[model samples]
Target: MKVLMVEDDLALGDALGRVLQGRGFEVTRCADGVEALAMFRRRRPDVVLLDLSLPGMDGMEVLRLMRDGGSQVPVLVVTARSAVQDRVLGLNEGADDYLTKPFDIEELAARLKALVRRSHGAPELRCALLRVDEPTGAVFRGATPLDVSTRELALLKALLARPGQAVGKEDLHHAVFGDEPVGADAIEVLVHRLRKRIQGSGAQLVTLRGVGYLLIDEAMTEGPVAV
Candidate 1:
């Protein structure tokens, strides 16, 4: 599962990121509320860990905007606000769970995992005009369906799983080919094929030198290789 953790505290963010990564969760950190909200829309993370006290905008406002914008992604409020009213307000505003600062790392991780599962497991993966219906292995461009081979569909699924973020070639290979043997540059071939399929999808394919590839709306991009 992917997590968007919005915390301005550098030390806490780094430590939690490391712990979550150890549990096989991909994590991205955002320091300020404004950036965090933008990234949330771009990344479509499985869960959000938000600090109530934030710069640019408060986390509460971010939560409000997300709900107002029709975002169904789960959010967990993690802040130092331990008062009863603070917890009540966060829940009322749409936080899936609340965790106070100086919390037990293990409990936090467990709660996050539960929230991920409670949010209906894997979310409906959609980015711009590209949408993947996991149940049917169907790919769509708006209301229309696109013809795609199994390999092509798998490649797109992996790429769009984490929209606007670079997905490594090795990860793509595993996602697409599994344990099957494949020649070098196999992933690039698949990427090229899929690129043609998604042309004019409102999102474009981007290569980050040696890092990997990501699909993003050129207009929505704030920077290269970042949502």
Candidate 2:
């Protein structure tokens, strides 16, 4: 995947660019927000890693401008600010994901993969006769279309993307809520709604005791059942 990384710190920027390149990603590094925005429009990268502090324009302003200009490219905000308010503000401004500084490279890669996966919009997730579009937020059971909210659609996409894997609650939380603080039962509520909407669609939503939720189609795979 191609990525644009905007960071004022030259050393860190070089290190990150190298790391991502090592992982088979084409990276373009920019030292300021203005350059970052320009490169973004010029390259149209698959993902953007934006730093909060920049030389010319601030990261928040850049994000606002991108959204105002109708740029829906997935953005992952990387900043030193660990405060909840800072993260919240970034999310509100249009960041798809937020990671504080001093983070593990592995986690960063995972988040990037998730973001890119969502952006590319996986073909079709089939569980029995049901099918879903990971990109356009379209859901279908056989030939019928089901109405679903954006949040519910995102939740379903996150679940369907993993197939049989058990997606942890925290990961799902981040995918759906971004930086917002949601209650423990929030996932349950959303799952309930999804289940209702997908009724008779040959797909099932199951809970894994203390782990998290899983969406399964009986025809897809037979494994250890968690309910």
Candidate 3:
């Protein structure tokens, strides 16, 4: 699993990252809120561990930004703010889970895994010949893995989130670009590129005009799936 740790303490971050790595997680550490937010958008980690007392931008503000921007990639607040109000605030602000500092590493790992599972509705997603390992960020076409970029990965993730049904372009836009400014037609471009890349994967990316896009496996494939 890809884990992003937004922590200011160098020693702690290093230790925790190593621990998570040992547990088979891909960890990326960031020291402050700005880096955390930027990395969250660009890297698209499966789960986030955020510290509330971050420099420049507080963790709460970062969480708010993520929510406002419509990124639902599971966030877990790990902070020294252990007060009841703090926990309440964090959950209210869209954190999937909360863990106080000085926590057990095992428990942290369990929480992260649980959050990821909940996000995907399971640990693995299978759509015909395409398979997505939610934790490892590995998308496979049968035994061969697909060469997908971060943006393309984000798009595929969104599509897989709802198999066999059309997903609105606005929602996908939020997932890929967040608050980043770009042309309104950007989602269409992404769909076009992703469609080409996913060809012969026994999966289809379908465009529903006046609606959005839908992805389906061969088993569910029927009719002309696009506009």
Clashes of each: 0, 0, 0
TM-scores, all models, native as reference = 0.54, 0.57, 0.54
Q: What C-alpha lDDT values do all the predictions have?
A: 0.82, 0.81, 0.82
| Every candidate's CA RMSD | 14.1, 10.1, 14.3
lDDT of 2 by residue, 91-191 (tens): 99999999899886645755676678778875456676667754334689888988988678668877887887778888888767765677879988898
Write out the backbone clash pairs for model 3. Answer: none
TM-score of predicted structure 3: 0.54
TM-score of 2: 0.57
| Superposed Cα deviation of residue 126, candidate 2 (Å) | 11
Cα displacement (Å) at residue 44, model 1: 0.6
Tell me, by TM-score, which candidate is best.
Answer: 2
Model 1 lDDT per residue over 1-227, tens place? 99999999999999898878866689999999999999999999998989999999999999999999998888889999999999999999998888888886645765676577668865667778888765345788888898888778777767877876889989888667755699998988888888888877777787787899888876686764432
Q: Candidate 3, residues 3-103: lDDT per residue as tens digits?
A: 89999999988878877786678999999899889999999999998999999899999999999999999998989987999999999999888888888
The better candidate by TM-score, 1 or 2, is: 2
